[model samples]
Target chain A: MNAMTMIELGIAIIILIGTIVGFLSAIGFLRLPDVYNRAHALSKSATLGVLCVLVGTFLVFLFVEGYFSIKLFLGIFFVFLTSPVSSHVICRAAYRSHVSLAEISVRDDLKEAIIENNKETEDM
Target chain B: MAIQVLANLLIGLLWVFFQDDWSVLTFFSGYLFGLLVIFILRRFLPTKFYLFNLHAMIKLLFLFIVEIVVSSFVVIGIIIRPKMNIKPGIFSMETTLKGDIEVTLLALLITLTPGSVVVEISQDNKIFYIHTMDIPDLSNSVLQSKDRFENAIKKVTR
Candidate 1:
């Protein structure tokens, strides 16, 4: 009985942490200055949050129920692998599509590099 | 990698037999146990296809998780504040890693961390264009990121 309660408590704490992370990610998504910043929030926090939730779910199924889920483990691994890739793709696409940077952005190092490369090419 | 997978699967099957429970957890535990066994015996294993150092890979994973938690808190702190005092910028950094997989994994690690996203890769793949949320000191930030993430990745992948 005590062991079961301890397991339940552990599950609850894990789920709670996951929920808090998801909440923070949502807040970041709504409050950040631009798409890039929002993308950061969405990618990092949401991915971690989802991972935590999945971990909690995994524990629940393992401890509360007597079944183990290969699918859940696969889902967790897949999400961990793919979420960052998707975010990188989106950010690159946004940059190529000429999405404007936030007003406080102080540097465009890529622009300068591109200009230098172009100049060198012309010299050739 | 194929050999590693096969060995792990065999270990997992053995674990299930021992546990007397044909469940995923038992199998997974067995797989992990197999990995540990392999890690221990890596020095003696006469395989030419050892792709990575197991200890370094584990360290990298631990570092990544720690960075995620810390950065998440930092971002959260910034978001909940009344004034959004951010200085975002795109910066280029030179990388010593050359392989496609290494570069891609490095980029993914950077993107997944807080306050930075990989914007582009140079034609020669020698440089990475990264967009960072805060750049109080450009050189410092670059060096910190390189030390923290890039170095570990290089150890694991290269």
Candidate 2:
């Protein structure tokens, strides 16, 4: 009914949604078939989950605490920028290390490219 | 760059005056606010360098948000279901965009999108090796990724 209560309600909803998303990401990690799929689950769901939580925290600080912190904004930005890069690096390393794809995978386009590169190097 | 820094300083001072707070946090917030203002007016400014188009950036951001939410649900569905019949595969996509920044941005976008992760980039940077969780039709998947993610990034960076 009051402004403070309303703000509290909004923050609770946001945090609840974020918690659900984080739970789903963990489920995805357990249920997905392969490393690539697991990575997808971790990167997309986990990143969004954290972002939601951070945004909710930002709102809380801005509305309830009556002060803004640049640290929160920077935390959100750094997570947004770095998560994808780290995921990409992990996937790339996995691929290069020849981690087998899922059994149902239909294609291996990178295999052909790598083979072609090997042939070119051999020719040289 | 010097002018931009001076303008940001002025904005920061103004923010301190209005907020009645002289903390480092408020100063950085004001500087960020100034950068945002300049970003919005980038196109109209007389600068030699190609300023990022705010509209394109915002559009890309919106697209990213939508994609993230949609894909998160999709992945969650795949996970929660009793039967998981994912046909994952690595596909090579040829891109028109050049430069490390543009290509890297595209790869990052693809990796962030649900059901896909970029595994490799060719030596020439023309092709991206992406691993997708579902690839019922490889060509269609490649085309869809090109249209959905790559094109949006191209609009922003190119």
Interface RMSD, all candidates in order, equals: 1.2, 1.1
Candidate 2 lDDT at B95 equals: 88
Scored by lDDT, model 1 comes in at 0.79
Model 2: per-residue lDDT, tens digit, B36-96?
8877777776652233455777888887678777767777777778888778888888888
Residue A70 shift from truth in candidate 2, angstroms = 1.1
On TM-score, the candidate that comes out on top is 2
CA shift at B140, candidate 1, in angstroms? 2.7
For each candidate, the DockQ is 0.62, 0.73
Q: Tens-digit lDDT track for model 2 on A3-122?
A: 899989999899889999999899889888788879988888888899899999999999989878789999988988888788888988888898988788888999999999999999
Worst 10 residues of 2 chain B by lDDT: B45-54
Local distance difference test, each candidate? 0.79, 0.81
* Model 1 Cα lDDT, one tens digit per residue, A11-110: 8898899899999889889988778778788778888789889999999999999778888999988988887788778888988888988888888788
| Worst 10 contiguous positions by lDDT, candidate 1 chain B | B45-54
TM-score for candidate 2: 0.82
What count of clashes does model 2 give?
Answer: 0
